[model samples]
Target: MSAVTDRTEAGAGAAATAGAPVMTRRLRVILLLLLGAQFMLAADFSILNVALPDIGKGLGFSLGNLQWVTTAFSLAAAGFTLLFGRVADLFGRRRLFLIGMALLTAASLVGGVAESPGILLAGRVAQGLATAMVTPAALSLLTTSFPEGPLRDRALGLNGAMLSAGFITGAVLGGVLTDLLSWRWAFFINLPVGVTVLVLAMTVLKESRAERTAKLDVPGAVTVSAGLLALVYGITAAQSDGWGSVGTLLPLLLGIALLVAFYVIELRAAEPLASVRVLKRRTVRWGNLGGLITFTMGSGVTFLMTLYLQKVLGFSPLVTGLSFGLLGVAAFVGGALAPRLIGRFGGPKALVGGLLVQGAASFLLAGIGGGSKSWLILVLAGTAVSGFGHISAVVSYMVTGTSGLPDGEQGLATGLTTLTQLVGLTLGIPVLSSIVTARTTALQATHSAADSVLAGVRLALLVNGGVLLVGALAIALFFARGTARRSATA
Candidate 1:
């Protein structure tokens, strides 16, 4: 009997050892497909920037309405993300993901062949809506598939790297495609990639939904979606219309009112779209705040740097895009190392440290002067350093934000995190651009145009760095206190 038991145990051990590699391979495949979908969605946000002029010309878009091509996408994506995220949880994450991928592929085809501005705009809107469905669903799938530990950390790190790489790659590819082929290629390029991902996903991905589904929260969804749409529109419009203008204020106020109403509705709902209790968690709240700070300041500084490169140094669009290659490489490296850092220092500490590093890099960039090619070296160094820190912070915040939540709430948590990212990206450039414009206008009376522009860029960079520092300090203190309380209770 003893010999028989020994043999059974040995056989079980051998089988487990043999299956380890197979499990690892499967996880890798799943990660790749999930990241691929995320990368496509993220890249779409920036892919059309360089191709915009060509699109306007080809599609007969007026100067005033051309911005809508991008704005429409941003508005739909940011507005509907939270609603779709909850919907994905209640219904089916895998189903929504496939639907989104298919819609994105079809929308790309429509936009690629568009002969009128209206047709192109409709396609852009569809792409945005598809992205809203895809982003949270893919993230929720990743979080649910990987157990909470170092493995999950590594997956999220790769996700962060892919997101950064996608944005940078989009800019570069947009220029190359526009200059070499045509702007239509910008839309057409997603075809093969999307179709490939869709095929692989259907085979490799498993279906996942909340363990206990609840009824759809229609009122909560409507109010939040409408509010977000109005808010995003107002923020985007502020770039052209002054902040105080009726166009901006009316929507802004209406959005706020609707959002407040949504919250009130949520407090009474049987199953809230976003659980107030879950949102009150220390990690979720502070982590999201940290995400907002990093994305807003990082994107704002990047835009200012772009203007400095193109407007001040007179680099062409393609050259400017190429110059950002170093930043992308640094971000990739940073993301690769992020899981190790988090394992060593824990999420909160890593997040604070990343913010500090990013802030310091922004300060270094604030030293740029006017009319000197030498500043290019500083620009490259600053961008590279900031990119590293920015990706690290991004990964840390995501890990922190989604940690300590149940499988059921993963979709909602991911939605909130992604929403912050979208909001920050949408609002950062316009807000900072307004400040720079005001400052430049004021300085134009006494300074040369180049000097005034440089001054504005420098000032914006300072604000960017300052805000990062403040946010880091706040998060560090909050987390420190929470840690103390937990330790005491334990």
Candidate 2:
């Protein structure tokens, strides 16, 4: 009987060992498909930026209407993301993801073949809506599949890296495609990638939803969605119409009022789109604030640098895109290192350290002024360092935000995270652009064109650094207090 038992144990061990590799392979495939989709979505955010000139010229877009191509996408994405995220939780993540991919494919086709501005803008809106569906659904699937701990952290780290890479690569690719091929290829490029991701996702991704389904909160959804739409539209309008203008203030104030109403509705609703309890969690609150700061300051600094590179330094679009390559490489390294750093130092410390590093790097870039090659070196170094810290913070904040949440609520958590990201991205450039525009205009009488531009950019960079430092300090204190409270209970 002892001999028979030993032989059975050995057989079980062998079976388990054989199955391990299969599971590993399966996980890898799933991660690839998900990350591939994420990369495509992120890339779309910046892909058209460099090609905007070509797009406007090709389609005979008026200067007034040209900005709508990008604005339409941002408004739709920001407005619908939270609603779709909750919908994904109630329905199915895989189903939503597949549907999003299909919509993206169709949108890409429409935009690629569009002969008029209206058609292209319509396609952009559809693409934005698709992104709103895909982002949270994909993120929730990842969190649920990976389980909480080192595995999830590592996955999030890679996700952060891919996001940074996608943004930079989109800028580069947009310029190259517009310069070498045609601006239309920028839209066409998504066709094959989207179709492939959609097909593979259907097979690899398992459907996931909340364990206990509830009725959709229609009022909460309507108020929150409309509020976000108005808010984003107002922010974008502020870039051109001035912050004090009726075009900006009307929507901004209305958005704020609607959001406040949504909060009240959620408090009384049977099934809220986003649970107030979850939002009240210390980790979720501070973590999202950190995310918002990092994205806003990071994107804002990049925009300023782009203007400096082009207008001040006289670099072409392609050359300016290439200049950001070092930043992309550093972002990859930061992403690869984030999980290990989080394991060694804990999430809060890692996040604060990243913010500090990024702040210091932005401060360094504030020294950029001359059009000399020496200034180019400063730009490269600053971007590289900032990218590393920025991506590290991104990964850490994501891990921090989603940590300790129930699997059922991962969709809401990720939606909030993605919402902050979109908000930051939408708000960053405009806010900083306003600062630079005002300062440059003020200095134009006293300084040369290059000098005034450089001064404005430098001041903006300093503001970026200052904001990050303040944020890091606040988050550090907040986390420390939370830890002390937990210890006291223990």
Candidate 3:
């Protein structure tokens, strides 16, 4: 695929981009396959949220074990992503991508036909692992395919938009399919898409790998995967088990221990799965930090709003999904504009502005409770603004994180990018919900149930906004300033 372009009139910047990768007609096809994989994986994260009730009902899951429907997927994703990133470098990106897609196809089929909770959970875990394998390879391929310039930024922007759209669509599509057809269709839908991506990818893509790859770091991979899995599980457990309980604290502590061991192992290993040197770069470090905040706050608002709409406002699953779909549209718009914004304002400036927008929106939402349908305007507006902020930050931070890596390291770099995002999203729920629960308890002691929920939501929104604002400032001061200019030139 030739990515070369004719841009004589695009100004001096155009000439500067001439040396970047060129795409022929096949370039578009390659991009579609890559972005399609991205959309599929991202959608899987939220698609099942709406289908969970139906799935649980059909499978006869107990309340205690029910959450595994989602958690199993999360655990596999968080745990295996980094390992698979390194694997892509050592093996081959295209090979891994195709394998991952095939895995996803099989997983979807298994999930769709599952007659038992165990089978369904197994399918979800397989899907998560498959996603972990695919994401890094796809990101590596996309980033390497388009060299750094307007093209790369635009590509990343579009990729971000597709990701946002898929996430938003999943929330809505799950309900629509579940209500009209069956929850099994949620899994079935993935089957065709996954297979198509795999087939097209086979035809449209060439194999790629590190020019000088080394042996895989088995210990580092195992320790890190186990460490992340344990930690993520602990973070999730904290929501239901209480942050201070043994169920939460024990695995958390163990996870901490394993992670410490992993770091130690990496420092000594000749070829670490994830290079400590690359991670030490300021952009990589801060980008992940900023990404963590953006993703956490952005996903946090959606999670809270979903609760408010369903529990407080008594919206049906379909209505709730459709309501959030508006946010998705806004997100795509923001994503489309991210390239121009980054080009004009630079990544750091854009990152700051985006975070600020999200913070302000969260603050505005604090007082927006009480299930009155009249409040829909405020809800939609707040969510729309927040979604814009999120997509903007998402693109900016991804560029920041992956910039300057050699081709061989791109997989590891993107793996880290994905790891931070998934972790942030995974953690957002427990952290924000905990605050809301506490406030709701305090309010319920004295106020009407509806009033208490409203009060609780208001307080939670305040905390969410405050934290985002703080995170924004931290990113601005610590990560954004000098790199923006350099990346622009790059």
Scored by lDDT, the top model is 2
Q: Where does the lowest 10-residue lDDT sum fall in candidate 1?
A: 16-25
Q: How many times do residue backbones clash in model 1?
A: 0
Per-candidate RMSD, Å? 4.1, 4.2, 3.7
Candidate 2 residues lying further than 4 Å off, grouped into runs, are 1-23
Query: How displaced is residue 307 in candidate 1, in Å?
Result: 0.6
Each model's lDDT comes to 0.91, 0.92, 0.87
Per-residue CA lDDT of candidate 3, range 219-314, in tens? 999899999999999999988899999999999999999999999998999999888899888778877887899888888888888888877888
Model 3 scores worst on lDDT over the 10 consecutive residues at 1-10
Q: Candidate 2 vs candidate 3: which has greater TM-score? A: 2
Candidate 3 TM-score, C-alpha based? 0.94
TM-scores for every candidate against the unseen true structure: 0.95, 0.95, 0.94
lDDT by residue (362-435, candidate 2, tens digit) is 99999887757558899999999999999999999999999999988999999999998999999999999999
* Deviation of model 2 at 307, angstroms: 0.1
- What local lDDT does model 1 show for residue 283? 88
